[model samples]
Target chain A: MNAFIVIAVCIVFVYTVGFALSLWKQKNKIGAMAVLFLAVIALVLPYFSYFQS
Target chain B: MKQNEGKIGIRDYMAIILLTLGSKVSDDTPTLLYKTAKNSAWISMLGIALLSLIPILFLLKVFSVHRNKNLHEINLHLFGKVMGNLISMGVLLLGFSSFVLDTSVYVDIIGSMYFTRTPTLALYILMLVVCGYGAKRGIESIGSAAWLTLFYLKATLFLALIFAFTKGNLKFIFPLWGPGTLEIAKTTGSKLSIFADFYFLGIIAPLVSSFKEFRKGTLWAFAIVVVEITAALIIFVILFDFTSIEVISYPFHETILYLSIGFLSNVESMFLPFWLVAAFIRFSFYLYLVVTLFGGIFKIKEFEYLVPVFIVIVLFLGIMPKNLTYTLPYLREMILGILSPLFFILPILMWGMAKLRGDFKREAEQSH
Candidate 1:
């Protein structure tokens, strides 16, 4: 994995975590989970092809 | 000028329409037309304009009754919660995919055409960050920025097109119906989604100062975009002819590169900033729409916060394709094919529902 991709994903993960926690505090569990799920998928997408190469 | 809270007036609304839809000519849009219609691409464009007017008028009629409701709200009211949310979600999926593909295309244009040294990921990130910030500021700011720069953007574009026309061979436009009338009609049908952004404008219908202004702005902007794009198609054919243009991915950019103004040898750099501004505003508006629709679907009130999430997703997905120049167009064609029927039928369906529900009759009664 490239360092830049890792750094970018980490930064996005941090933002996602903060947002999901806030949504969770507000009792919007589904929304929070959806956000995290989407973020994870987005983060993981590049790695599939990366490993293939 | 005193105005309603967070509302954009007719000029601002028109500016958004012109920039978002009008800028289509500068990208692979013309290439798509040229590939099928050949020298008669402009005719297909005109056919598209005429066909597009039906749905656009239907959409306006729908909004004329539901004056205060945006698209999602109107869908819910007309179709009830379960079905409406499903439709809106489908729309969101289509719109989101279009955004990702379109933005990737623009980023490819920037990366491949201009910044040959920059990595795709970096360019995608930078483009999305600027657009996300604009989206975060809200549509009012985006509209104002678009309106402010609208004149310069169109002026630079007009200058380039005029120069290209002068350098082009008028005879190349001969054999006006390049393939045939049937092919032109088919092209028009397949690409009717070129005007599909008009459907997305419903997302901001209530944000416009008045329904009348919204209707008027949409019509005026629609007419202007049709003429502008048709003229661009004809001129591009005249400039490069159909054979050369079919292969040239970004005709407008190529035209600018092929132009020189008197003393200046290269003028594409001059047009770059204006085009960049339009591109930024265009994507910013798209981001705002996607996030807005996402929020509406997911029951999230503050959808603006989702902008960053979407930006990250779009960036990653956009940079995924190893050979974007080849892959993006194929994907875009598929999206356009999918969106064309949806774009045509949805508004008319909504209007039929509205009619059956007596929404228009109620509006008439209220007016009386």
Candidate 2:
């Protein structure tokens, strides 16, 4: 659904920016981990879309 | 004492007030108020504000007596170790439980509204990790971050409300006071949850630079509440009339969704990031306070060690409520029946005890 796309994109975008800011603050480990974790979710989230009513 | 080491300055205290007030005036409050007071939710907010003064005055009296000591130290002084520790543990439990419930509700709102497909557990983990990171940074970081978050939150909310006003309907808010006096009382009592967490201010009081500045900060904080309540009133009157708002889980979010500016549609999405940031800051600050309170009470040297344990507790509490219907009503009742008394009564009792024992003078002399 359109709701799913909008949310996914928004979450990714916001988290990416937040992670970048964390990196700038020298929280590199946290920043890197956040991106990697969310990236994996972003990839996998689409597969579950078939279950949506 | 070193400049940064002793106590926080006026700016920091101001930041705390803003942060505290901002955290409470989120997506949840308006809906809760509407449900309780019907069309006169704004009136109930004003009533609650008046009622809240009883507690605030008590807290101020306590701080006036104790001067610079935090809540934990004062408790230890008054009740000694065992009873003080027990009371401190009670406060900790109340704070932590409330924070967990709040954070979960926030996550659920986001998940339900936006990411319907994503598991609630995923959202919970994400929020907890971020909260833990912020908590690890300590009070100073939280204060400064609060300053920034408050700025964005105010700006975005103001803009949204202003934009929504252009498409306004004055007719929606007819017959301001709803059915009867008992209904108004019930609604006002139910919405006391918004002010329940003001108890945390006692613990943070020592960090404030001066009583004069803290008083000024409290005034500013109250002004923010006025603004929040007015905005909610405006939105309710304009968008939902009265009956419809009472039924919605988050009437404010729904109001934002109805907002449109020419080519731009569904601007609530733009507001979502700000909402998330605000929620994270609020939840994390409360969690940090809970941990700090536990550490201080138990005489633990390093509070950071308890972060994981608290996180696990929050996770359990967050998931325990099966759905919003169950969770919200329970929260409302709990705040009014249990939390409100502690929030209002404890500070007064502490202040009285401190005065009666002459501990205040002794503590002041010792500190000097």
B-chain TM-score for every candidate: 0.98, 0.90
- DockQ (C-alpha) of model 2? 0.03
User: Can you write out model 2's per-residue Cα lDDT over B1-368, one digit (the tens) per residue?
Assistant: 11123456667666656666664555576766676677777777777777777777777766776667777877887778888878877887777766766786687777878788998767887898788777766667677777777777778887877776667677665566765667777766655546766677667777777877776777677677666766657666576677777677766677677888678897888888887877777777787788678657644435554555456446545765666666765675575566766776787788788788986687689879
Error of 1 at B83 (Å): 0.9
Best by TM-score: 1
**Once model 2 is optimally superposed onto the true structure by TM-score, how far is the C-alpha of residue B18 displaced, in angstroms?**
2.4
Which pairs of residues collide in candidate 2?
B36-B187
lDDT of 1 by residue, B181-274 (tens): 9999999999999999999999999999999999999999999999999999989999998888999999999999889899997899899999
Clashing pairs in 1: none
Model 1, stretches more than 4 Å misplaced? A49-53, B1-5
lDDT of 1 by residue, A1-53 (tens): 38877787778777877887788889998788877887787678767644344
